[model samples]
Target: MIFYNGDLWGPMREETNSWFSRIYSARYAACTAEEGHRNLVLTMAMDLSSKTGKELELPIDVNDLMKGL
Candidate 1:
């Protein structure tokens, strides 16, 4: 996705494969594009924390998605 004034922003990965199925498991099932998008954002946050060791908290629920809009 292109950059803009969006609430949930992160590096978007094409989910043509089961990238998160290992860690996220069943939660990755039946996910709307929106939910999968949210999972990717959280995954990015977690990855950043792992790389930087800066401990980041990411929400995985749609309730936190685009509430600003």
Candidate 2:
């Protein structure tokens, strides 16, 4: 299922968090922002791990992965 990992923290940051961008499957894909620029997979993992108290191994879509930039 689509899950939110966590947000990114920094001294000089524009945004507070990012989403799990790349996922292994559609169902497992993350629910990202509308603009799509703020969503970051790494940050998501960190967030989910901290908040939910569980480790997240994101599943990335193979087809989408190939098409990703």
Query: How far is each candidate from the true structure, as Cα RMSD in Å?
Result: 10.7, 14.9
Best-fitting candidate, scored by lDDT? 1
The residue-by-residue lDDT of candidate 2 on 1-69, one tens digit each, is 223465444542332222223332334324446334334545545655677676655654334333432
**lDDT for 13 (candidate 2):** 35
Q: What is the C-alpha lDDT of each candidate?
A: 0.54, 0.44
lDDT of 1 by residue, 18-68 (tens): 555543665535667787787777776666566677754456343433332
- Candidate 1 collision pairs: none
RMSD of 2: 14.9
Would you estimate the TM-scores of all the predictions?
Answer: 0.41, 0.29
Candidate 2: residue 66 Cα off by (Å): 22
